[model samples]
Target: MIATAREVKDRVIAALNDHDTEVVMQYFARDAVYVGPVGPAEGREQIAWYFEHLLQAFPDLQITPWCKVPACDPAVSAVSEYVMTGTHLGPLLLPGGSMLEATGQRIAVRGAGLCTIENGLIVSDRDYYDQLELFSQLGLCLPEAVA
Candidate 1:
């Protein structure tokens, strides 16, 4: 069971490196939830849309897996640590329907993901990453700079 979870976790990391819409959608359940920097996205279709936009924003995105571990229930839980490297080459849309212009900056940021699997598909996957760090790498600054 744990072995299956580990393979799923590894495949997920590999799929994230590509731009294919189907690749990103295959691991998710129909009603899966994906939590990321912006917020939680409910449903597999929503999660697929998120990845599509993300790949557009970072056309050369690559994820390097650092670690993967079985967390609980073997086939039900796994955690992954990785570094996502990419260049901002297209508009990045925000949750509230606003878009950040491409800054053409490159970022290699550390991130982690916790995934819950049911019957070999992801039911819930929460990703933890430094959004502020990503913005900083892209040279984004608020109107009022903080010291």
Candidate 2:
């Protein structure tokens, strides 16, 4: 049976909720591509590795979807925008051979994701989020002045 977009969307959210690397990996196609704020990554192994590292670096990370749209086919694809909130309570490797100290600071970021499912697995995934928000939370920048 073809996978409905709703199923795909639900599974994606469920995976995040589980915060289990194996569970999240189960939803991806073997050759799926993932694009996030950091950059593009391909294949299940790479995506799993990235997620695992992220989970280690931010143990309290959670993502919540704000808007969801199922494709016309109700299968194969969908787009979802989300808000991610987490605390920095572990080492975050940065440039210059330095790791940022965990400030226990909370961060909320806006992000958008596009996913394509084929053969009941997500064959492609793409996401975009605010880098500035991360920088600001890390004490690298002053909060932007409101208009």
Best by lDDT: 1
| TM-score, per-candidate, Cα-based | 0.90, 0.85
Residue-level error in angstroms, candidate 2, position 63 = 0.8
lDDT (10s digit) by residue, model 1, range 41-82: 899779988888899999999988888778976677888898
Task: List runs of model 1 lying over 4 Å from the truth.
Answer: 1-3, 145-147
Best by TM-score: 1
lDDT of 2 at 77: 84
Per-candidate alpha-carbon RMSD to the true structure: 2.2, 3.8
Q: Which stretches of candidate 2 lie over 4 Å from their true place?
A: 93-99, 142-147
> What lDDT score belongs to each candidate, Candidate 1 first?
0.84, 0.80
Q: List the residue pairs that clash in candidate 2.
A: none
Residue 37's lDDT within candidate 1 is 89
- Model 1 earns a TM-score of 0.90
RMSD of 2: 3.8
